[model samples]
Target chain A: MADDIKPRLRVPTTAKKGEVIEVKTLITHPMENGQRKDAAGNVISRQIVNALKVTYNDKPVVNVKLDTAVAANPFMSFFVKVEESGTLKFTWTDDDKNSWTAESKIEVA
Target chain B: MNTLLTRRTALAAIASVIATRSALATPEQAKEWLAAQAKGTPTEGKITLKAPEIAENGNAVPITVSVESEMTEKSYVKAIYIAADGNPNPPVATYEFTPLAGKAEVQLRVRLAQTEKLIVVAEMNDGTLYTASREIKVTIGGCGG
Candidate 1:
């Protein structure tokens, strides 16, 4: 569960100060919902990315509470105000108690 | 004959309990859930919900919610709720935002059990509620897949 998890992010390279910019993220995960049966007819235990948090310049921008209804690869897009040059940090936590983090930087001119 | 009747009554009771547990929320139930979350706040305009009218695969349906807001210190969107009336879990996801979030917009992927109405509710900083809803037709089921 820990080896294959990967976090991806996209943000503008540069933006005018106080400008609104879009941030997109996608994570490669199986997001097993725990309801499916394997070849042996045993129910698979659920393992999903249940939460995601994004911050810009150390300020929290978006916090999402996900559920089993989310698909295999979770993708999220939101907007943020670039007040200064800083790094955007993204974190994903799964049901297995594993957490992954990724970061991207943006220049506010 | 008396013993048979008693056994039948017990079976009926168990069946009713199982039905209640597995049944999905009806339209009214979903509405009540959203209303309770609103907490007497009036639902007005300023919410835009984008979802495909027809989803080829219910396993991964893309949805976006955007609200008209300046997102300044004085006023901004505090939270957003996504709900689907037909799914086993009516409340899909809830998002929280701060003033640093320039716009009140969020995009995510969700699963639909069948054809149902998806609802988006936005809570403003001043305690106002804005809402938008759309119906999505799912060709293939996604929840159990």
Candidate 2:
């Protein structure tokens, strides 16, 4: 794991069968647009998260496409309905061909 | 006699011209942006967008959107759209959510080209529309100043 890259998420370990849970995620990564110029006037080259995918218990939940407009250390918060106890998987991919994945488990009450 | 007539006409024409110019300038180019957003008829009380008054950094400004709902199978927030008035491309981001997703809320960091009003529009499952806007002042050339 890249020390600079941290995935922050909110997931309750336990939930009711039909309970609805809110999930928030923020990743600590420098989303370089690659269009910016350095002190030497050279293009920084885009290093942004191109895509983010989230799955719950091997079931696809949310898929996102990130762009240059996404700021550094991107933060995204949303909701998920918990039908059963399972694992939530989050993955983010960058332009430099790097993929970061994190998983959190939830238990149904 | 002709000189007097010319002078009077000149004065009247200049006055009328100045009056028209002032009338046109009264509506700043910025205010027109807001009117242009609600060009169509939308249902009432559908969306609420909340943002800070001043952003220290133009690069990363936090934005949040919330829709009033129960997140039920029959009623929920369908989609949320965000736009910045003065940015080069106003459409900042678009999010789509389903009933399986309980509450309709999204918090994210966005880049503002400059200080401008950020608008958020939420489309509910029932086809109603609610909108809210907030102005964000972005300090130029700074890191979360």
Candidate 3:
């Protein structure tokens, strides 16, 4: 498993019913593209967070496929409509099959 | 005077074509990439891509893509693709959306190696594709910087 992998999310604590809100996410990752060499001139193994999926209230909101070109600490911001109070789930999967998840809740008033 | 004006207009048209061809990915390359991703034929329009014209740091260049859509059960943006012409891996990211998602807009940060044209293609639920592109200049390298 990757070390020190952490998922971060920014979501509003409250929202109006049926309102569109912005959500931002970030994850700490090295995102090794397999093109780098060490001091001894050996190619580092490729390890990247290749996919990210987000769900709101158990319904899919967004699914992202990332490539080697993505930089370290992947960050994404997107919009979602809130119909009721629920939790937003975020999952990030890497090339090594390691995955991390985080969740946030919002209240609709 | 009329003949001179016509000749100048023709010259301008040819110059513009050359400029675009040099800056953008070859049609064949774009087609092959799109086809590999299983995206059907993409027509140009409806996709709006916003990125910095000049990025001081290539490590985290912000980008946003929005598609015209009505986010209904019958109609919505199915997916959105972001690609770079000069990156080692041209395809940067793909965002898939459903009607339940409500909107067809996304913003993310990407690493660009150098000055290159960024392409955004949005696939509609109806299987139609809309595309847009922009050029971004990077002064610092993402990997090393």
lDDT score for residue B38 of model 3: 47
Clashes of each: 0, 4, 0
Can you list the residue pairs that collide in candidate 2?
Answer: A34-A45, A34-A46, B46-B130, B47-B130
- Recovered fraction of real interface contacts per model: 0.77, 0.46, 0.68
lDDT of 2 by residue, A63-87 (tens): 6666655688888977778998899
Candidate 1's residue-wise lDDT over B1-145, tens digit each? 9999999999999998667545854566667777876665657689988899999999999988899998988999988888888876676777899989899998889988788999878888998888888999999978663
Question: Candidate 3, what DockQ?
Answer: 0.45
Task: Give candidate 1 misplaced runs (Cα > 4 Å).
Answer: B1-22, B25-29, B32-37, B42-44
Overall local distance difference test of candidate 3: 0.83
| Of 1 and 3, the candidate ranking higher by DockQ | 1
Q: What is the lDDT, from 0 to 100, of the residue A90 in candidate 2? A: 90
Put down candidate 2 lDDT per residue, B41-72, tens digits, no spaces: 45546566767788877787877788888776
In candidate 1, the residue pairs with backbone N, CA or C atoms under 3 Å apart (3 or more residues apart, or in different chains) clash, namely none
Root-mean-square deviation of every model = 5.4, 9.8, 9.4
Interface C-alpha RMSD per candidate, 1 decimal: 1.4, 3.6, 1.9
How well is each residue in A1-65 modelled by candidate 1, as lDDT tens digits? 57777888888899999899999999999888776788888988888898999898778998998
Candidate 2 segments exceeding 4 Å error: A1-6, B1-44, B125-129, B141-145
Q: What is the TM-score of each candidate against the true structure?
A: 0.86, 0.72, 0.84
